[model samples]
Target: MKNDVFLKKFRQTIARYDLLEIPPAAGLGRGDKILVAVSGGPDSVALLYALLEIKDEFNLRLYVAHLNHKLRGRESDQDQKFVKNLASKLNLKFFSKSIDVKKEARKKKLSLEEAARLVRYRYLENLADRIKAQKIAMGHHADDQAETFLMRLLRGAGGSGLSGIPPKRGKIVRPLIEIKKEEIEKFLKQKGLSYRTDSSNLLPNYFRNKIRLLLLPQIKKNFNPKIVDVLNRASNIISLQQQYVEKNCEEILRLVCKSKRKNKIVLDLKRFIHYDISLKREMIRLCVKELVGDRFASLTTSSTELSFDSIERTLSLIQKEKSGRKVKLIGNTWAEVSGENLAIYSRKEKQYNYPISFPGKKNLRSLGMNIKSKIVSRPSLPQKIKSKGEEVAFLDWEKLKGQFRLRSRRPKDKFKPLGMQGTKSIADFLIDMKVPRYERDEVMLLTTKGKIAWILGHRIGDEFKVTDKTKKVLRIELIQKQK
Candidate 1:
């Protein structure tokens, strides 16, 4: 009878939020073990108590993770103690990590707001992974969802951003995403349960707090009292559309970038030129990220929008002119038109190719190199030029820029090094290579661009090196790990 009452009340609440029609939990499989992130706030306390109340129904094994971002000093410590004591009362396993949030923020070069959230999520994610928990639940209620949606919307976030807080995101789930913050407070009051409030939440300093206390109250006063619910509905509708677009993006990636052998993603410009603007922008940006990760392309995401400017332009020319064209792109990769093959460099990697032809599945750190190759039957190349300082890959001869340029150091730089071999002093030969001593080795030799045009003590075999009669292509990969 107690379980029946709990279910009836829960169903009533779900219906009030119009979440009664929410899809079954069969997809997420909440499973038995659940990790909950508790901040001792009213919402979290309600979430914790509700989970405990319904544990038997869900067959749940719950663990609590908390982050002590020591920004409030003693007050923060008190919050931590308050949470620990409650966990003790509840007989729940409690995990806490004391971190200098300010220091971390500085070290990560992030704003305090961004860094705190980042560290908190990192700790929670690690806890979930370590415990092998399937869902990491949080206490974000509908009010929080509204704030996030408005914030992202103001920031010019597209549909993905407007989707707001999802009920489930990877291992992280907000089980109470449909619950209002005040209702949680009411639930706690009815049960005579007390919760600790982070005083900072009331301050106008943080954008979220300002939204919660100032903007939201103003909206309720001027417009409607149910603004949060209205925004929540808006976010849900946006989420549906966002999911469709995301699904299409995944398909686009699979189609255009499937054959890329290495971490680099090569775009087939022909196929890509056909996509509409929205998908084209996303596909192009994803291609850049897939090949080079986040560090490459564009200054700021907001200002730069998509990092596909160069690639998009190249595609435009290909579509507009129906001819061969080439453009240099961020992250030391190139988008090129050669014969019938329109390609985005799948091998945008830049690693030291000190010694080429290292065997497969290697950790050849000693060679100052990290590259890979699949030894298939030797495909005929347009030309065979060694890794001259200005050459990294065995590319088609026609692609070569026609002039061999090498970069390396020389004091009074004089050398009759190979090909231009003669008793030219280090000064004269370096002058010939037009490379400065400081940048001679680390100049990252390329065709005036930072591509792997050469590796010092190697060959400057060629650039845009493919020839007219070329038949096959050799794929080379480079890796420069940031993590």
Candidate 2:
């Protein structure tokens, strides 16, 4: 009777988790090498134990990586030791580290949570690369997922927020996602296993801990009794459907973002106005993620997901001004609308329009034309390239690099004009030439070894002005249809 009852409970838990292993073709498979990150907490410990139980069935090679954030001093070390002992007893390969997470947080000038998470993921990614592991398993469960969904919803999130934590992501998988906190505790009790409890979880200061301890419990008691289960079910359904939405989003994105080299994306407002709200939001989020790097920064809280910092803003800017307009985005990134397409570009890409390192032979493709160079006789350059008169330049022999850099002019740029005696600031020179407001900003400078040698389509720098001493000069030319 007891055996039957245990089996029934186990089966129910598996059903809830969606962890019923199918054939190796569908499921994670037996003996799949998985790296489990354990924190010695109840959830992670439970996951470790469960994986151990199924180790033989799965033909699994398991590795345990435990991080000691060292926030709690002795207690943190104790947790690390516990995980080490547990891994040792189970004969699992264990890697442990006591990281000075607080110190790193201070060094990076980031919040404690942000720094620790970044450091942890970086370490895990590095380990994954070294081990060539397909999956890195974490112990986030249903309760945590439910709380995350609720928190993101409160924080002005759309359906993407509702999607919550995934069971499997690239090289990262959460196998215990279907298990709830209560169910996990019950399983540990049934197995006569004890797990370390982090006192921080009881504290109401951390937003997540507070949700787990106070908000969710209150919701369960007064609002929804099976809230966790309902959320898990909703998340599962959402996850499956989101995959379809993601595929649609990818297709829409390909049409929307036309050029990778130009770093721009556009939602044909006419076409964008058609999709249903869910798919529309997903498309917007995915495009922003690809162009901008994170899904969190995709859109605003609205169903349209049209954030002020997104393609919507780029479109607005272009509508107001058909000329060059810049939108400074998150970090070192910016976006602008050029012609019909909304272009997303980082500040670095825009500011460093000049080549950073012109190493070796390069086929120049900027300046609305293509120009190729080879070490040959001075006569190799056609008369059109040689005597384009003021438009052509002969660079100094000593300054030429097999490899050089090119970039846009900076405020600090000052050079002595070839015929002039004094150093002239580029700022003054552009004013002297009466370079138009719009065109002036678009002017690019060719740089070699950190100094501007020439401004493309305009004038060569004073130092690079061909001198009598400069006999071996790099011939500059413009490819033209010869008359």
Candidate 3:
């Protein structure tokens, strides 16, 4: 690979993905800060040099970041030192961090690779934020993409996993994604650049190593000589298809989604059940992606956390399990069949009990809702007011007895809904109304004299209904607060 060829390919990948542009119209073609993740290996070292060669053309301010996982003891330190020295030689800023990946793996109950990858990305992202970098560049190339595809394929991964490595994900960009590993090494040699080699990569202990050193070679020798190119081509096609699927999934998600919070998503089960199985699986993946605070592309290609079995279990919970049943998911998330809906939540649902003040507004933080209570005289009410939705209720004020409080439902709670004869259990009423079980705790109740006055946003109790004989009415309104 000639110097000009390597640079041309690098620029081409950037152009194809629009990598350097932050907002497309930002004219970020020049004077952009970039943080380059360098591991002192051949691929990363080549990437740094390649970017450095074109830095002036793009008017780029490049910074180098390295994480010493400390797995190889002295070798890890040497790797960090090499990266720092390279950055210094290039007259660029350098940042380095050391972490005991084995210790972190044990403490976090994760694999060594998982722990190291997580810590490395966190340090890079934080450093990038601190430096106000517009882009974080990685050295993932064609060979890595093919290996990733094979690994995921063997693990029974779906479309998302089979999509392979992306050229750009969020602020992370891979300029070498289209370049072959062999071409990268040739470029380094042609440029007389030296790079450190990790001994661990030669060992077949890790799954990736097994694929790179063992499986891939065997396939190339016995199967197709150009297996890497074949896999890469397939991944590119699948990636395009996956992007289209993701777009459609997002549109469908809007229809099925009932409520979306920072760490929770409630889906209407009645609407969800009507979708095809493929759509359902993709929707589940998208929900997990949102709950985990991941960019869609990042989760789709690189994440194996949401396994086929985990998604299947969630689907089973939605289809077969009784309402209120939940299945645990990755990243401290849970999927529960809540009556007429399915809820994916990262945090535990909490119960709220608070005092209600008349003629005042109260914010319910737990429910992300607000309650406004006011007393209105019947004579002052409009003659032909528009019919109110479930959020508004008119109750006879004279019938109210003890102190008023807004709280969640308790066990065996019963209320005589307006226009209904006898009392019905709160649980049964919620079921009959098709309210999700996860939302039951969030349903506010206006209670006085140890009796339910209204199921806020649902129904007003029979005892508190406004009538012709009533002179004053307790008007309560429920408002959903923006998260």
Candidate 4:
């Protein structure tokens, strides 16, 4: 009867989270392959058998994977061997790798546990990508979730962290997340299945182990006997609350946002400061996430590294009256306060310089765009005299002379903007236009004979503006090339 309940709950957990269901994005589909992360422990062993029971129903092609941290000498090798044998016995494909967790920990300046987790997930993701697997399944169970909640709670984590281990994130799924460790061990016992144990788990050296070994049992005996269920329930509540908050944060982001690029995100300082303090922090977190999304291997890992102290430090830096100050953020990113904008970016942008030819499209490699220039007769052009959009500009062709070159803004650059009688410093002009300081470096200028003709994607010089006397019109178009 208990064995039946275990299997029933296992399937229910998967269904509840849509673990095996087809996702909206290019993810799991019917009869798709899944990479199962099996460490040969009781939790993993039970997970493998549970998934096997539903293999035909889901049409899943299961592949077992194991990562040996090599922290336990012969024991690590034995764990790998056991997983390989288990996969062979089940007639499933197996993948395994060995890494020095201690060495990696020292090199990456992370704890042994953190290093092991990072390296293991990277290996699993790479293997899944190589084999074209649609999903990667982990063996994290309810007990692990409860422990994670306690750990993060102790560290003063917010709602995002308090949500605990997610059932599914991207291609990584934890079908066993709703199952408990004791239930897993009992399930394996009922099936007469044997599994390997990592001896390090018995030692109370690691904080997680200490929490699992020392703290949980006492709380269960002296306090709530169903602490795991309590924590799990709390995590679900927090996750739901966080989802709502994220939607509001996204809406607020659009309002305060100045600009966003691949590696940089700029927010309007004037607008950002007016919002409630909590909203400001959430907006900063969103900016960090946008900039660091591609930098980290997984979303959960990035969330864990986004510490409260780091967020507080960023808030402190941006709130100060001083500009040009920067603070380091997680995932190799940084936050800076530059004039009227707060910039969160990874690295400095490079300068761009390229030649433009008439009646031809020149691809600006650094700008990731193509600038097409052509001469059209006034009769052939639209009746409108001024530019319709920043991307498309029209100038008096006869007034311009010599070849045009597009380059990054220079320190001494000045331009007489259209409708302005006198020339103004490009730097002051951009500042008056409310362009972020960091983004000013990326602004390009189209110059002819050492004079600014137009600021690409922004403005056209007064001298280049088309007039009624202009017979020929120079049409310049900026086209963004697909990545």
Return the TM-score for each candidate structure: 0.64, 0.74, 0.76, 0.75
The lDDT of model 4 is: 0.83
Point out where model 4 deviates above 4 Å: 22-29, 294-304, 348-483
Off by over 4 Å in 3: 22-30, 295-304, 348-479
Candidate 3 lDDT (Cα, whole model)?
A: 0.83
Write model 1 residue lDDT over 1-483, tens digit each, in one string.
Answer: 333443355545435543312334534434358788888888888878877876765557789888999999998998899899999999999999999999997886766776787678778878888988867778888898899887767666766557777776556666577778777777787788988888888799977788888889999999999999999999999998977887789798777653453333445656766778788666655555555542331122222233335756866766675444556654355555544445555332344333233224434453333555342223443244454333345444334334433233324433334455334554454445644222232433323222333333333324433344555444444553321
Q: For candidate 1, which ten residues in a row score worst on lDDT? A: 297-306
lDDT of 3 by residue, 1-483 (tens): 358888899999988988875333333555678999999999999988888877766777899999999999999999999998998998988988899999998987778887777887778878888999988999999999999999999989888888888887767899999999998998988989999999999999998999999999999999998999999999999989999999999999999998898667988989999999999999988888887874334433233267888889889887785777877666567788876778987754566677776777877776778778889898888754342327888877889967988887887899887777899999888888887555665566778988988887888887777767889887878888755
lDDT of each: 0.61, 0.64, 0.83, 0.83
Q: What is the lDDT of residue 248 in candidate 2?
A: 74
Best by TM-score: 3
Give the better candidate number (1 or 3) by lDDT. 3
Worst 10 residues of 4 by lDDT: 294-303
